[model samples]
Target: MAERDDLSRGLWAVVRAMWSEIGPAGKAVLVALAMSAVVALVLGVAIPKQVERHLIDAEIRKLSRIVGAMADAGVIPTGPAQADELNALDEAVRLNLLGSDTVRVKVWLVDGTILYSDEPALVGAKYSLSEERIDAFNGINSVDIPNLSLRENEFERGFPPLRELYVPVADDSGSIEAVFEVYHLAEPIETTVGNIQQLVWASISVGIGSLAIFTASLILVYGRSIANRRRLAEKLFGELVRSQAEERTRIIGSLHDDIGQTLYRIHYGIEDLRSRVDADNPVAGELAHIGELVNEVDGSLRAELRSLQYGTGEELALGSALDELAEVTEMETNLSVSVHVETDCELSPPTRIALYRAAREAMTNVRKHSLATTVEVRVQRQGDQVRLQVLDDGVGIIDDEGLGLTTTRERLEAIGGGLKVKPDRRGGTQFSAWVPASECEVET
Candidate 1:
């Protein structure tokens, strides 16, 4: 029973998968084939029976015509006939109808009296009639397989199966005068039915086979087209990512080379001028403050530049990069920041960069929007995914996310990762991000 259940489930899964992958046209074709197969099966079984019925009907009509002709020729007696007359009737029946196929014949009166039969013993005998035989008196013809077990059919006992046909004989006034009954060997009719069934089944099989091949070909063509389109889309996405990375690297290089050095020189010039002035001079005080401001700006710029270079440099480990982010956030804002690295697995460069960006974005939001006094950054590997969580003790949950965070989420999702932000249990907001570790693992 368990194995049967498993097999049913497996079949259901395959059907579901196919349903999801195929288009409307493919589904329609499958439905049509299913309906056609059902119809074909029904016809395959029913047509053979109809053919046998028609064959029996043809035999009854032939026998009825022969009997009617004999009556018209004055070969049948209306009342009880003499021994000579009976002999003449029997010979006529044997010559006209009795053969290998037509095994028996009986002429009967409306009162259930057998007038003449090829078997001499049944001549002028009376027997009780069944409804089917009585129906012949009303001009209704029928065919059936006779029951040889009955007393009336004792002579036909041990005989092969036979088809019994009944025909009503009419006089000159269109009145049924007598009933003619004929029995034919069933083997010939059965053989004919078998041959016809073979032909019908063969035709049906050919049609179904052709339809199946057409449907399969259509599905194959459709599947290949979908696969090709998917491959093209993936290629385009990869190229777009590479181009963006290159552009970002170029911008980082320009900032570090030109703006960073210029800022450094301005800070030193201010410091030198302040040192040369008198200590009591108000001008020296202002110059000292300006130098302090320039130094702060330079420090902030250098920190951001380092963060931008994390994945591009030789040191692409996320653990160290996250620690640096915590330090910078703590220095820039008076927030107490902590870092926890709970996993040792190396992440690929893209994963490292995505995680770093998520962390940085969360910290920036915390500093700008949250009136938080403390923050915690944690990284861990769970199953096949690496997760990053940044929690800040701040004003409860915020409903709207900034544009930077939205972009960060898209970037993470592009690499089979996702981002979430919710209210932390510690009375602050928690920013969480996860990426598939299997796909983002560094090669050994």
Candidate 2:
């Protein structure tokens, strides 16, 4: 945790140092999508329109060639004969139109009268009475219809979109004889463009969806990894705290039990030696007893320090820490004391020491300042947390500057713990500390 915070702070400091700014991720996504849409539109519209234009132009040229071929061969009879006399042009038109689904060919005489047409009515009657037919009849070999807005001949048909090319075919005597025109329906080209657009959009959508899924997965994975690291760090810190407490307890026990006992033995030997040598060595015996008394006092001090810091690094049963506190308060103070512990989760060594200190401070304050008769303690495990309380039926400290209570709060917070103190329901004060159960467990 310490390293992570430091790294993060340094990186952010560098970013701030550079005065760099970043756009929002949402805007970036939108811009990327919009660019994709533009590309899709180009592919969908431009390519197909170019293809349809090439195909329509080719049809027009082919129709012109067949009409010229018939005019060259004189296969179209000079005057009306059997319908079969038109066979050469008819055959040419049918063959060319058959090869293309888009082309429709028709033939009309010089008077705007249809001679033969793919449409039955045009074969015998006048055409649409449009200027397209008039121009073709007046020796215009190539009269292309302009689009609707130009106040000119309609470019193509109504429902199917229209494009027409009129080619005049002259007789041997040079009189205008007929017009051969090819019509192309634009609707199919438009429909083809629409399909292309749908396909392009589908591809772009799929690509974006894939990118989103991949990015989301990456973020989720990183978040989960960070969470696991935090949990492990907390666990390690708990273990380190418990280990330090255990080591301290071991050292204190050694000074009190082993070193103190050896010193006492040497003191007794010296006292006996002095008594034997100088007879009536009252001071010597007295000095030996004083030395023993000093050792005893030292032992008591060792025990007190051990109680504050001792541990086996195991989960410390709540009853044990509270029992010791209750005993000390009852024996030293006039206040009647009671302690109750109901918990299934035990606290680790550091937490136990913290709780013991808090409870001890509260009771000590009660003894020194509170003119109260009764003190009550309750420790309970609520869900994942262990809660400890010390209450006194005495005059309670009103100010926040009370040294002991302030220290208790600070200690709890140091371990990611919580502490609170309030007036008891019956009269006096209540002090409480709560910490997580996982922190209490040593190896387990």
Candidate 3:
């Protein structure tokens, strides 16, 4: 049972993968082809059988009519016959019934005696009547392909498969007197059935071929439309990115020119006032403290400006960006930071941005939560994927992620990348992020 469940899940996963890979038009074509194949198979088997049955039924009816005409004309033998009577009966049988397709004929008495037969040696032979022959004595007409393996059918074995039919000959009182057994060639009916089946199969083939052509045309058109849409979306997304970068640059410039210069002037003014004041004056000490506060605020503002520049600027490589982040992190916290990045492939703008954000978020988490100091950041392109790892010698576990890390994770996931945080084997927290390195272009 477990194996069966696993097999079912495996098949389902394959189907889901196929479903995702094929677009809507391809899926429609696949379903149409499958349904058409089933239909053609059913008709291919069933139509031939139905046609053969109809042809055989017609042959049986014709045989019955021929036997009935002989009975009506008093040609069939009713009992034991003299030599002259047998000769007359044989003449009548040959003149009226014998043909290429009508190979043999026999008249049977109630006691299973061959009262009359075209085969001379079987004129007086006796055989046990089967249940079907007995039923014919009660006026039931039957038709079948005789099995030549039976002892009674030894003479007929030399012939090809023949249709065996039984027709009851009745007297004036409507009581059956003898049974007429007929053997007719089956080649005509078989030929007719074969021709009909060929025609049916040919028609099915043409229909399927036409459907395939139509489906191919539809797929081509749909594929072209999809490609066009993708190109348009990429163009729009590139424009949007450029516009956002320009807006961010504008904001950074405004803040630097307006707020930054004003704060700098305020700090300089405070320092000059402190220089002119008496050294032992209490007010001078207070002015010095105020200048220090202003300087700290200016430093924080400059750090924020650098961050904004990093996001908007396009000149820095991914490795350089991570190195700059590490330096800033080391400066702010009492931690030693090491960086290693080995990648030869160029990265897309979005991938570069996402990886940089992941590193920054991981560093922020380390600063806020982890206790120990030293940190190491590593980046490398492994096969098709580019991986980033930030290891800290701090505490090994984090109970929860802050909103910054969560947002970074979502951003990475949006670009077919992922982020994971776990405990390192060497007693530190490990932050890992990865994106497909082969996907060097943005996708809609």
lDDT of every model, 2 decimals: 0.80, 0.63, 0.79
Q: For residues 1-444, write the lDDT of model 3, one tens digit per residue.
A: 977887785665555434433456777787988898899989989999999887777776776787778778777777998888788878877886778788888888999998988988888999999777899999998877887887667789888879888888888898888998888888888888899999999999898888888876776677566545544544554566678788888989998999999998999899889889999999998998988898899988888888788743355788888788878777777989999996655777766766877888888888888897899999986644689999999877678777888888877765556899999999989999987554332111
Q: Native-vs-model 2 lDDT?
A: 0.63
For this target, which candidate reaches the highest TM-score against the unseen true structure?
Answer: 3
Local error of candidate 2 at 48, Å? 46
**Candidates ranked by TM-score:** 3, 1, 2
> TM-score: which is higher, 1 or 3?
3
Tens digits of per-residue lDDT for model 2 on 110-174? 65566776554445655454677677777764535445553222323343556667777777676
In order of appearance, the predictions have TM-scores of 0.56, 0.39, 0.57
Query: For model 3, what is the C-alpha lDDT against the true structure?
Result: 0.79
Candidate 2 similarity to native, TM-score: 0.39
Q: What lDDT does candidate 3 reach at residue 170?
A: 89
The better candidate by TM-score, 2 or 3, is 3
TM-score, prediction 1: 0.56
Clashes of each: 0, 5, 0
